[model samples]
Target chain A: MILKSLIFINGFALFIGFLILFLDKVISRYGTVTITLNSEKEFKAEGGKSLLRVLFENKYFIPSACGGKGTCGYCKLVVSEGGGEALPTESLVLTPKEIRQGYRMSCQLKVRSDMAIYIPPEYLEIKEYTGEIVSTELVTSDIREIKIKLVEPESISFKPGQYVQIRFDVDGDFDYRAYSVASHPDTQGEIEINVKLIPEGLGSTYLHALRPGDTVYFSGPYGDFFLNTDSKRKIVCCAGGVGLAPLKAIARYWLTHASNREIEFYFGSRTTKDLYDHSMFEEMAGKSPNFKYFPALSDEDPEWDGERGFIHTIIDRHLEGGYKAEAYLCGPPIMIDAVTDVLLSKGVPQERILYDKF
Target chain B: MNLALILFASIITSNIALTYFLGMCPFVSISKNIRVASGMGIAVTIVMTVTASANWLILNKVLIPMGLQYLQFLVFIITIATLVQIIEIFLDRFSPALYHAFGIFLPLITVNCAILGVSLFAMLRVYTFWQTVAFAFGSGIGWFLAIIAIGGLRKKLMFADPPENFGAAGITAILAGIMALAFIGFTGIASL
Candidate 1:
């Protein structure tokens, strides 16, 4: 009797599934969608798919951190025609200028009919690069410094603080997760990112399980979280844990020009062992008079000589005449919020403080 | 019962929110603005009416014959979810304006109690097919009327100075109570 009952239940489920599929075939089937790209190229995509999914399938990947979940506003395209009105979710991300210019979130854009779209030229250049892991070092207990040398393209160049989206194949579907480029910009054939393992994070788990010399597919440097070269304000950088990656690149990138401007770097860790590298910053500061390094430890540690307590609190005692200082902060939200609160308290305008929180 | 009386009874006399109190979720949450409230109301009414008749068919033709009457809740929900999905895809492909107008609310209808409630009520009351259709349509319109009315009142309430205790939800709840009392008068007009 139990066996019969189980069989009946399975049969019912299968019948419902098949029934739904048959109905979908009759009702929701659209043959094809023609998409015009940049007014120069055109391609036909399978109809009844989101524009983001179709574009990625065709190898024209617009950067989407949320994997077409419509949370991140990265995958935006200007639809010249055949694209419907802005989705409610798109309003959270698109500026008034972008909205007027007919920008729509590609993830939310369902390709029902032929569409003419304008994609940024930079995004058009975004391509997947195959590389071999040159080295993977335990920079800290939780952090790994992954250096990948491109085998195909041989090189990648990016602004000091921009990030790259590494495509990870998890559960048979590729998810693109963004990471800031940690290595110096001068490194032509290689790029490094400091990845701290996030608890149960698919991307971090995949990155952490990699062996040296394994082939890696990390795509181009994306994101506008770069240093403003035009700004003459004193650059004050605050970092926590693996957040030091982008700030290191920005600080070193600024060192080449020297700008004759003061650049103070504040790196905070739980203890001395959690810190990635202090000697590199110290060596750079020794040579550059305008450069300064302040490494702070939040927890107690023996035989350590540096500023103690939270990095924000440490910077609180030192920030003076900060009217000309533009703070660049990168870290976890706790540190970002603490540093931002401290910075704001010291009369730093909200616009002058820029940060990337993980 | 006649169709016009059912319609009128649903819209005024026996409002789903104000009378049966079936769809209070959308009534309270989406009843802030008149435009959104009307959109939500229309969407709910359409969903409720469609789901009710469809559930009636399933309950009679599928469950009753098979002696699987105990599976009413599960099957009913599956039918409602499937129907909502079909409506969404249809709207997306053919009616972009309506799809955009519905936005998140169309997808949200799957979880709404009002759609499921109409199906349950139809099953419980043991109405015939035609009667079931009328009740479903009436119930939907009644829900629409209640939400839109509340929506308009709430918008005006925004400009009015209510007591300190009447913040968004408190004021809306108090108003709902008064409206429910008014709807009690409609009970004398129609006996659905």
Candidate 2:
């Protein structure tokens, strides 16, 4: 009787499983559809996958934070044709104005039919790269510097201050977190990034645990906070904590590529131990007449000798007569706001003051 | 057993939501907006009807005949989950409009205690096949009514400006409690 009951239960379960499978096969089979991008590129994609996944497979990387969950609202793209009405989930993330303008979260949009989408010009250049960690060093107590050597398609071309998104698999769903490149853009075969542990931050925890031989997948060359090489005005760069990564790239690229341009870099930390790699900037300053390095500490310390107090308070002392400078600020929101105010008051035009706040 | 009375009692007096309080998770969450709440309600009603009826058949015919009545809980839940999946696929294929309206909510219904509760209750009450269907449908409608009412109340309560300590969830719980009390008024009018 027990054997008979076991067989009966198994038979019932198998029958239901097969039934569900049959229904899924018949119902979800939407066939193949053509995905046209930017009115220029077109590819055939399976109808079941989301537009974001389809695009990702095609090597076109769109910046998204919450993977394809539609929670981040960062994967917005212009779907010009064959895109249906926005679903309820998409409506929560998208503004009414954006919806009216035909912007939809590609992650939430299932590719059920032939469709046309417009990708931004710069995003077209974004590429996914797989690399092995060449080195990992604890730059400070909280911050670690990771250097990665690209394996496939070994060279990457990106502006100095742009960032990349590292992909992580949480359960089965994909989650991406962005970090700015600290290495010089000219270092095409490799990249470096600094990660500061933010207790309980998923990306930081994962990245911090990575060893030298581990492999990672990341996409990009995103963000517009890069060095404006065309600008003839003097460059004023300021960074706080780990925000120095992108600014380091920008300053080093500027110092190496265009040494004729006057540039000053100001790095702020809480204490002496919080500050890192001032010697590298000092070395660069010694070589280049136009480059000046100022490392400041906000908190009191007996061992400190350089500028004290906030970086915003010391900005005026450096630019007594020189106000024709474009400011590049990257830090916490409060620091960025305070520094931007100082730069604006110092006669830097609002448009010329670029910032990326963490 | 009078099927009409079962239906009436379930919908008005012994509502699965207000009285039994089975599917409180979706009740509080989906009740924030009437449109989504109605969609969820309709989806829950459809799922409950089919799963409850299927479970009743399985319990009376297969389980009792095989003397495997002890496996009722497991078998009933499996039936509900599989039936929900099949219903979702069928709705997607045949009823495109209805599928678009509540299709996304089908996944949410798979683990809903309310659906499981209907099947278990039918088993406990020794309900016949048709009676189980009526009870499930009525319970679904009862849940639907409660959520919609709470949603409308919450919408108006947004402007009332309750204390800061009573956040959205806190305010919603209070609203559900009050609504449950109001539903109690119909207790003696009709009962199973």
Candidate 3:
């Protein structure tokens, strides 16, 4: 008789649980605004939901390095109207120039009423991919080479120099970090990413913990760092540490198809131990007569006999006759700034240099 | 024992934000301006009241009987999160003006420790239903009052010359410490 009563009470409690959850859903369903994005797309979003969340749910991608935390200041969009007051969160991230141009942080702006927003033309074409980790290898003591087999899309079409945002589920929250796609665009079903373990970074921490056969959430073919096909100028590629990600991607593309340009890649490192995939670059140099690889070490052992000095010094010595060539630099802010000064002094136009600094 | 004493004690002696240091993030960030701070203060007050009452019902009626008392923290957090989401939706639909005023701060209230702190305190004290409601409402007003007073002081300080090292958070922290000390004077009043 006691067991029967206990069973009845448990059943009643379960019913109450369902009731509460159901009521919550019912209450949430009452209020919401319909948003029409870019004129062609339509989504029924919960009214007062942030524009970023709405767009994300509708498969419209906006670049947000901070994963809706409103910290990185990357998610910006042009809203024609219907976005309420400029939020404090958005104000912290926007510049006076951006404020005048109607650029608002999409994550901070909520849709109180029906709204229209114009996303960048490039963001519309970005795709999300599900890929399986096929291999994981250590590139440096702290950096890892993660190669994924594209599961759903079968293949991705992207410029050789672009980057993708890798998303990881950490502590019940989704965190995203961007990494340059290192594999050639021509490679089907396989995507390669070189990640340096950021000391306490959410994505890097998870990437460091991951092993082969893990499924990871990644989206992209974003960023505009690809090589300019119109220029026949000599190319000076400067890379430091994991900045090798995009440089390697561009090099893979250049080796496979584009053979006419003169390319000299100057890779810088703190010590000889920092170098990875040296044989791969040497193989590429052997295959392409126009390509040359210069691995410069800032501190070389006594037994080492390669170029020793800062990368800027090496470029200064070898890049004679001023900058008649386009420059692509990817490194720490200090290195990028120092190299920019050197390259500009050598006559490389500021507009011709493309770079991304963390 | 009565509403007036409860109000007085809550607003002065035991402010959730100033006394317990709950909801300090929004207190510091939103307190830069008086107008916005007042809006956020009011929003927090309303949400705290509603969340406390709802959580009391769930705790007394559901969890206690099922021997699920250990789930209090998790249940309270999820309840607050879901309640904030629901309230945000309702506010956007019914009153766009108020929604615009409180829109930015409403979502952040989910993580605001004051709301959770009040709910947990109410449960810990095991207040009667009516007492729970009164305590919740009183605590909300206390938080509102503290933030508004600090906001006004900050606005005034903006024009005054502060010491070289006492700018921004330095001055705010000193002022907060002084205010907390002053609030101790109210402790002599009849306890709630």
Which digits, one per residue and each the tens of the lDDT, describe model 1 over residues B1-192?
677776677677877788777777778889988898888878888888888898899889977887777778877888888788878767866787998898889889899987888788778878788878888888888888788788888889868989987778889999999988988876888766
Report how far residue A227 has shifted in candidate 2, in Å: 1.6
Candidates by lDDT, descending order: 2, 1, 3
lDDT of 1 at A17: 77
Candidate 2 per-residue C-alpha lDDT over A1-358 given as tens digits, one digit per residue, 9 for 90 to 100? 7897788789989998998998899888888899888999899988877898888877889977565767868789999997778878899999999999999999988787899999998898888899999999998998999999999779888898898998877788766788999999999999999999989988899899999999999998888788898878888989999999999999879877888989889999999888988788999899988988888999999999989989998886776434688888889989999998888888888998898877
Q: Using TM-score as the measure, which candidate wins?
A: 1
By DockQ thresholds, what CAPRI class is model 1?
acceptable
Instruction: Give the candidate order by descending DockQ.
Output: 2, 1, 3
On residues A1-358, what C-alpha lDDT tens digit does candidate 1 reach at each position? 5564456456766776787778777767678879999898999998888898888788786877666788778888899988878877788888888999899999988888899999898887877788888888887888999998888788888888888878788778787788889877888688888889889987888888888889888777777678888878889999998989999889878878654888988999999889778888898889888888889899999968778999999889888767779898998888999999999988888998988876
Better of 1 and 3 by lDDT: 1
Docking quality of model 2: it rates as: acceptable
- Tens digits of per-residue lDDT, candidate 3, A125-144, equal 88888898999998788889
Worst 10 residues of 2 chain A by lDDT: A314-323
Give the range of the ten consecutive residues with the poorest summed lDDT in model 1 chain A: A1-10
Against the reference, the lDDT scores of all candidates come to: 0.84, 0.88, 0.81
Report model 1's TM-score to 2 decimal places.
0.88
